[model samples]
Structure formats: C-alpha cells, structure tokens
Target: MTGLRERKRARTHAAISEAAIALFLERGFDEVSVAQVAEAAEVSKRTLFAYFPAKEDLVVHRFADHETEAARVVLARPPDAGPLAALRDHFLDGLRRRDPITGLNDVPEILALTRMVVEAPALRTRMIRFQEASERALAEALQDTAGVPALTARLAATQVVGVHWLLSMDNSRALLGGQSADERCPAAVADAGHAFALLSEGLAAHL
Candidate 1:
C-alpha cells in the first residue's frame, strides 16, 4: 500500500537524521562526511541524498515544517483573531508545551548540536538563511490573512521571528552552561511570554 510505503520511507528518513546528528555531535558538523552519515544509518549515500539534499539539511530539516506551520496557523485563525493575536496565541501555546522552537526542550543531544552549530561558521550562516526563509513564509501568510501592506507584514514577521531566534539562542546558552531542562524550561517559557507580550503591544497598536 502507498501508506505502508510512505511509513517505511519516513522511518528511513528519521533513522538517517538521527544517525547524522549523532555523528555530527561526536565528530563536528564540518568534519562529518555525508558518506559517514550514510554508513552510520546503514543507508547508501544516494539514499541519504534522496532524503536530505544537502549536509546542512541533516540538522536543519527539523525546521522545514515551520514554514507550513506558520501558513497553516494564519490561514486557520479564528474569524475574530487578528494576525498578531493569532501568532501570539500560537507561540504561547508552543511555549507552554515546552517546544524546542521556544528553547524549552533542552535535551543534552540538542544542546550538543547547538554548540556544534555555534562553533561552525557555515552552520551559523545556514541557520540565519533558514530563519529568513521562515520569516518570508510567515510574512506572506500574515499578508494574506490580514490584507496588510507588504512592509507591515514583513516587519511584523521579522519582529516575532527575531524574538523567537533570540529565545532559542538564550535557551541553548542556558543548556550549554549546564542547566537542566527541568531547571531551564519554566524560566524560558516565562521569558518568552513576556517577549511576545511586548511585541503584541506594539504590533496591535501599530498594525
């Protein structure tokens, strides 16, 4: 069946990603070869490439869903919900759930990956590029939902996404500094709530 085939593909993809992360954490992102990852996952290099096109994708693939998620939230917002309010609610919900995007899911392996990215110039650049793409996707969604000017949508998306990036960096720093998830998550959630509130105040007042 198509569904069964898809599930098998999904499992293979996850196995490759998990193996890639493990090797990257152990040997540094820049030092780990695609062939090495394929071997670790027990898949051929071609198969790995079929799943993730580039080396950067091995780590950043986790973020690919964000673009779709942003659009989906905006498109499905309650009739009375303004764009800013909808995004605020969405982010708050994620924070309460301690989602990784909020920097609350501070697993040791994730922290190691963060350190690897921080130390690698190429990875850092790729992350910035990914964030820009996510912002553009979110901006387009906001523009469609609110019928706002392009600039307004862009500015709003930048503000919200920038806050999220900062929060993720803060959480990574806390974890790298030896803070446990249990110790860091509540504080990160509270801090993110305050940050979103500040953004909401300005966003609601302006556009």
Candidate 2:
C-alpha cells in the first residue's frame, strides 16, 4: 500500500511538472504564475505547492535526479574501483549516451531546456545549490570509503564536481552557439578525455 500510494503521488507530481514545463517553455519562466500552472495541471494552487515549494522548482525539478548520484557511484563501485575512476567512468558513460544531464545531448528540446536554465538567473542559482549538495554527498562517501580526513574528502569532491560542472557548461555553450551534435560530439569527447585526465593525473594513472 505504501508503494502504491508513492507511485500515485509520483504520477501526480510528474503531471503537474510536465504541465508546468510545457507552459513555461511556451511562455517564459518569469511570465508564468503558480496559479496558471495549477489550472493547467488541474490541481489546486495549494496542491501544487505541496509538490514544488517555488516556481523555480517546477522547471528545475530534474536536478534532484542527480543530487546523490556521485555518492551512489562511490558506494556501489567494485572493490578494485577507485573513487575517482568510478566517477570518471560514470561521467564518460553519460557523455557516450548523450545524457541531457551531461550537457552532451543535442536534442532540440534538451538544447532548449539547457538554454532556459542557463539564461534564467533563478534557475542557474538553484542549479548551483544542487551542485553543492552533490559535492557534500560525494565528500561524505569519500570519507567513508577512503578513511580520509573530512577536509581532504571535501577538497577532492569539489575538484570532481567542478570538472563535471565545467564540462557540462562547455557542452551547453557549444550547442547554444548553433553547433549541431555531430559537429560538436567529437571535440566534446576529446575535451572530456582531457578534462578527466587532468583530474586523475592522466587516465593511465587512474587505471
């Protein structure tokens, strides 16, 4: 029963969010009001608030998907897998798959979503908060796995997330410049290799 209720709740949440994103994309994020989103989703204004605390959340909800991803990657890695290796491999896989979160995807809707977040001040700020949370989680995971001091774990997490953030932004900017995925992918892959190499002091070192 608990699982069923949670699934129903998730569906409602997604319905409201999908409606909100469609409306925001149609108009602009600043132009859309919570009341209008409620009407579009057929939920009460109060109900909408139950799912998303701020208007910014309606658009950036997807950021929550990755909030603990780095931590999970560290925790679940094979015994021989080093922390940095696990994270780098995960990010490289995301790039190969052209995951939207990696900013390597060139899909039209994804590109538009990237532009929306990049151009909107509120969304960008919210994204920074998400990145900070990811760093914290990664740091905690590193402390547990490596028996490192908290500060050292934190510094390592910062470097890892910083590399990821910069790569994502670079890819987003490339798409924003009107470059097609085909035109940008080869360079993006090569750049990701260089970025990860620098962090791990060369991919060979991580190996």
Candidate 3:
C-alpha cells in the first residue's frame, strides 16, 4: 500500500541519516565519503544519493523541516495572533518540547555534529547559504499569511531566523563547554523565551 511504502521510506531515510551522522562524528565530515556512509547504512551509494542529494544534507537533514514549520505557524495562527506573536508561540512550544531546532536537545552526538560543522569551513558556508534560503521561504509564507509588505516580511523573517541561529550556536557552545544537557537545556529555554519576548515587545527597548 502507498501508506506502508511511505512509512518504509521514512524508516530508510532515518536509518541513513543516523548512520551518516555517526560516521561523521567518528571521522570528520569531510573525511567521510558517501560510499562509506552507504556502506555503514547498508545502502548503495546510488540509494543514498536518491535520499540525500548532498553529503552536507545527510548531517543537516533535520534542518530541512524549518521552512515547513515556519510556514505552518504563520498559516495556522489564530485570527488575533500577529506574525511576531505566532512565531513566538511556535518557538516557545518547540522549546518546551526540547526540539533539536531550538537547541534544547543537546545530546552528545548532536554536540559532536555541531563541532563538526563549526570546524569545517565548507559546511559553515553551506549552512549560512541554507539559512538564507530558509529565511526567504519563511518570508514568503509570512507575507502571504500576514499581508505584510515584502521588505517587512523579509526583515522579520531574517530577525526570527537569526535569533534561532544564535540560540542553536549558544546551546552547542554550552554543551561543548562541558555543561550537562539537564543544566544547559533549561537555561537555553529561558534565554530563548526572553529573546522571543524581547522581539515581540520591539527590539528598540533591548537595543
């Protein structure tokens, strides 16, 4: 059945991603080839490429959900919810769930992946580029849902995404600095909540 096939595909994709991340953490991202990841996952290199077009994607696949999430939040916001308020609510919910995007899911493997990305120049460049693309997608969604001016929507999207990027980097730093997940996650959640509140209230007050 179509549903069963989709579920199987999802499982395969998750297995490949998990295997790729483990290998990347063991060997540097640059040092690990697609062939090696395929071997580790027990899939053909062609199959791996069919699932993830690029090597960087294998490590950063989780981030591919952001654009969809941002769009969904804006689209599903209550009638009374402003764009900023909707985003704030969404992020707060994510923080409470300790979502990986919010940096509250600071597992050791995630820390290692963060370190791998930080140390790799190419991965860093690609990440910035990916962020820009995600921002554009979010901006378009916000503009559609909120009927905001193009410039304003883009600016708002940039600010929101930038804040998220900062929180993610901060969480990684805290973890790498030897903080326990239990100790660091709550602080990151608090910081993210304060950050979103400041954004909602207007940055002029904080700046």
| TM-score top scorer | 2
> What 10-residue stretch in candidate 1 is worst by lDDT?
102-111
Against the true structure, candidate 1 reaches a TM-score of 0.85
- lDDT digits (tens) for residues 110-202 of candidate 1: 667778877888888888888888789888988887888899889988887888789878887887788876798778778877987898788
Arranged by lDDT with the best first, the candidates are 2, 1, 3
Q: Can you tell me which runs of candidate 2 are displaced by over 4 Å? A: 1-4, 202-207
Expressed as tens digits, the lDDT of each residue in 42-92 for candidate 2 is 999999999999999897777788889989999999999888888888988
Evaluate residue 100 in candidate 1 and report its C-alpha lDDT on the 0 to 100 scale.
Answer: 72
Model 2 lowest lDDT segment of ten? 198-207
The C-alpha RMSD in Å for every predicted model, in order, reads 2.3, 2.3, 3.2
Residue 154 displacement (Å), model 3: 1.0
Colliding pairs, model 2: none
Output the number of the lDDT-best candidate: 2
